[model samples]
Target: MKIPERYQPKNNKSFASYWQPTKDNLLPFLLPKTNISDSEKLVPYYFKVDDLADEVAVEYFTNTPFNQAIAKLHTDFSLFPSNKNRLSLATQNLFQQLNEVPSWVDFDLVNLGTSYCNRTGTAALSVLRNYCLMGGYESSAINKPLIFTQALHKGAVKRLADTVDFWMYVTEINGLKPNNKGIYAVLTTRLIHAYSRIQIEKKSEWKSELWGRPINLWDMLATNLGFSIAFIDGLSKLKFKPTAKELEAVLHLWKYVGYLMGIPLHLLPNTGEEAAKQLFLWSKSQKGIDTDSKQLAWALYDEPLRVTFTKNKIMKWFVQKTNLGYNEVLLGTESRQELALPYSKAKYWILFLNKINEYFDTKAKSNPDYYNKIAKQGRKAQEKVWKLYQQAK
Candidate 1:
């Protein structure tokens, strides 16, 4: 098999390391069963971009109406751009995909997933920020796109604020439905990624031969899995028990979301085991944490103090300590030190937090009414923080 220039690994050593099989993946049930040769076969996927969206990006610059057609999707997805903008076949094809609902999607299950996420509340955010997003910094190449775009200029706090808004929109009830902002956001993000690829390629520093297309399908799948399977891993460590159905729904929900974002449905995981397999395969070529990873980690770590949700110094200080406590427990000392996270005895806070969460979580599970109440409360708390994010400078 010929290794394409686009598929080349930034670190030759990591590329070699990737070909060797590792039994470790994630979770007790979701661990991947790998054959030693698995990584060798899938090496090219790392360089693959969303061709449809990339075409849209190419045509989008030449055809401004295509942009308008895309924005129209926020209000009504049915208005296919084919007739309106003389869109290229690629753009029209993307519009059609967005309009058609995949047969596998179960709205009830998707909502159930949303409710589960809602019920978990701040704990869910904790895993997403500290573990999934923060811990994801371990990748040297996958994060290069962010660094190339000067993401640090906006700072991690604003970036986190933007991310929260996007997550809330996508997880909102019936949010992914046609004509909803959730669908719109996903589509827009797809285009943004494509556009970013174009912009970054023009820069001299971007090494397409080593890093592949920006936000490639491989990278997108990695991120989507972070939200689904890896997210569950973090939540599990928090001692939050999600029912089997909740687990299934979360995977299904993210699968559809990933599909809309132009990730291949085949590549998206149908189950946790499938997710772990995909995760393990893609992770083979990734390099360990570098300067970019450390910078991003520290930014996220300090975000609690910068966010405007609470101006009270004492409360903000306590929240930072709590987050550190979370990082200490979830990320372990080795990872913590690599990212230069400050030391904290506050890691013990997990005991108290888990004890309280477990008690209430248990009560809610046994009583439907109580579960509904907490779901409502959880969503409210999230919205309040979202509002604060919006107000921040």
Candidate 2:
């Protein structure tokens, strides 16, 4: 079939249209109006997007009256310069414990050997990416009290609840229901689980740096970004209906991850060691890495980047976990439980989605009828989740 001229992609819209434009499309259109010829020079044209920030409450949340109250709480309390200064001081004191090696070994070089430190850096990158993706304003107006609250909140449930509240506010503002309980709940749960894993891993490895101390940075930053990437990519495939805001949030989060890893944000189709080169840039950007360390990490992490990772790898991993989860009743595993499901309706519908994608992969088949059937089911589920979320507010 010959493609219609209007329908054919003339520029980057080809890709943007494929994904369906959310807010990012606004900037590109506004560019020509600003009279900027150079795309790189057009970054400043985005001032309008950045200038429009305001703090608005959802006015309807029953469980949490304030929209993004938890995130706000975290920003206000824990992440302030005072708090960070203290954290840096602690880190500095912690740094002092490492045995004094010859100038050849170097003090800052110790973090490279510390898996824990690397992981913390990655986790910090993940959270930073998440906020950036959500367009968290880099504002002096950001409440320091909230920052402290988020960091100091010890219970995983409380922290997760805060994140849910932020998501809820986002959904309400965009006129979408918080549909897809299973995906959201599971994503949060797994992140916390990853956190626990980091802590345990760090505890086991904690050694004296020069005296052979185990490193603890893994629990700090890298764990969240690394683990969550796999989870988000999987969820994106199985998702039946995600609001534009939600989708934007996810994409932005991924872009930020790429940036911190030293990957250029424009890398398309998101695959291969070529992709990992960006992340390796992040790791090596730390002063003093010899050529050998950089090469080894890249070589080790490469298998996860192959195209097969998207097909068999993500599908296989996510499907197995979905089956093992509370929503597995939708998969015809356990009988549907009576407990109030967070995203009960979408949970069941998402299964059909999994199946359709699987058929396309394992059989190399495209069944339009089947895709339509799954999409219809998803629409119904989305309606249910959306209403439920709004009603709760």
Candidate 3:
């Protein structure tokens, strides 16, 4: 929801100065459902072979190889990507924690999924499996929760498409109308960025001129869709039975993404890297544009500048191209609201269980004491459920 500009922090203040949760801000700290229990019966959801992903994501917050590194950078994005060595180290740390998975995989999909929980929903069964390809993991460590056997054929690309669909859902829920071309525009922008990142990383090419070009709005919209849907999935899970700590962890992670995505500091979404200092500064300066819609509009307007840092001359080129981009928006766009909903099957329950443990493992390692307290009780409760399932098995 949008708020008036008068109440927001302006004058180019840091996000740290304005990042507080208020009733109508971007991401309010969500309270968990009161009726949660580990013993509740689970439904089924299945996995597919076409995606061929790991059984589950590595618990970067727990286990060996990368926990410490992740712990170090968990809240600090600046230091992690500071240099090639640091990036390598950060990637290595993640690799070890994640059973030696590729770095691109970590950032592109898995972390993106974790980030979704922060943006749209809480980190729960279907949510995690949907993001990290839980059915692909090899360990039982990934399979300690509710198991489903229904088929779900989704991938990173499909996730990108669904993100667009989810955003349409949220806007409808809020009684607001969506931009007809918004989702497609956003998706297109994301594709460009994704492609750019790949080319830059693989070819070691850095064109200063390219940096200033206005983002293909379609691609950026898709990126936002990815974020919002993930957040929605994570949040809806909270509406179901979830632990207090899980709620807290999910809340914490959500803030992180909100901040990174230039969410208003006062919106109360969640925290992100302190390195986002400049972006947050811009957000603070626009505090005058308050309501959720206005704030979102203002933020969206600021996106191109953020995409090209002030140091990049190309930003000027992008600014000049704004008219071209604006004209494109006038074209008729598709309304995803009418699209048929994707089916949720029974086999997915297995993948869902695996994801829950994966989420727990990451949360536990990130905050051992917190996870331990819950683990003691959770383990016992889990064993009881396991015995019951075995009997059925």
Candidate 4:
């Protein structure tokens, strides 16, 4: 990686300034079941990783206690390598890039994305786990790092907890600003990914030519798309309609988050059309599911059963099946089969529940009190979900 145009900011204006989900521009948010017609391609991004982090991680991990330091850095971003080290000037450069705000950032839009997350509450969580994260497993090439890191053995609850925490932090209003928890989360995650890439590349089993880097730029951008477009699409399935402006703001929010996380922002998508095309090509890179795929997917598939949110045996069963149904509905039949997730009658029942909620949501959204009440309900449910996972044995 030659570090192409490092700190290359996205050139698009704010969501409200230029783009709207008009008929000509309103490409459906759904991930298409067939191949998309697009000139852009995904193969090249596979050759890229976070060059700045890659350099810092290599020097730091090679010099320090690898596992212990990686663990400590989760709570302390200051442990990241600095300018004093003689090997390279990556840290001084990295901080400079982080501090320089891109011309495109709009804090109001960022906060809108956060508001959307909080308003939908547990539905956002469900959509993320079932649609975005679980759906990610079908592309077997991406799971190498998780397997290498013993993610399945450590359990899905642990993995999901970390993921959930990161989402919660970054979506908070003004969370991505310097010295904030959101910034801290991105810093910790970026280095952790870099650490994994280093460790995985050293293994005899990893074929760099076939899979690209362990967590290449392609995969990293795809993860960002998962949070941005895929997340919005998943919420749509639940009949939660965000305005055109709101939709674009969600993508805009993740664009900045991706920036802070050291993803090569030049390749990050700012609109629905761009995101759809990028994701379609990236998904094309998958070969098929294997044992490791099933092992990893199973971790999340059974996670609801382990959550200690409710002592009522019947309610727990309902929650478990609803989770399975959610996977079935959002992931489509093919992905459910690929993941080997069990069938549940609750899939249709779940759809019916959404229809009823949508009716109320449509009416309530016009009134501030009603919408705030819905958001409160959503926040409460999200808290329960997070607490149960935290308390899970």
Largest lDDT belongs to which candidate? 1
lDDT of 2 by residue, 229-291 (tens): 322322333322223333344333333322222222344113222222322222222222222
Task: List per-prediction Cα lDDT, in the order shown.
Answer: 0.75, 0.27, 0.28, 0.72
lDDT for 121 in candidate 2 is 21
Error of 2 at 229 (Å): 4.7
Q: Give one digit per residue, the lDDT tens place, for model 4 in 1-393.
A: 322221111331111101223322222533344352231255556667888888877766776896676654443345433423533567657655555678889988888777777788788999888877887887677777898888988888888888887887897768887667888778778888998888888889877665667888878988998898878877777877777777878989999988888787777877777776666555543555667888888888877666655668777788778888888777666668767878888898778878875875585478878776776677677877777666663
Residues forming the 10-long window of minimal summed lDDT in candidate 2: 48-57
Rank by TM-score, highest first: 1, 4, 2, 3
For every candidate, C-alpha RMSD to the true structure in Å? 4.1, 21.7, 22.4, 7.1
TM-score of each model, in listed order: 0.88, 0.25, 0.24, 0.83
lDDT of residue 277 for candidate 3: 31
lDDT of 1 by residue, 183-279 (tens): 7778778887887787888999887666666787778998998888878777767767777888899898899999999888888898877877776
TM-score of 3: 0.24
lDDT of candidate 2?
0.27
Angstrom error of the Cα, residue 340, model 3: value is 2.5
- Candidate 1 regions with alpha-carbon error over 4 angstroms: 1-26, 61-86, 308-310
Alpha carbon lDDT at 9, candidate 1: 34
**RMSD of candidate 4 to the true fold?**
7.1
- Compute the lDDT of residue 307 as modeled in candidate 3: 33
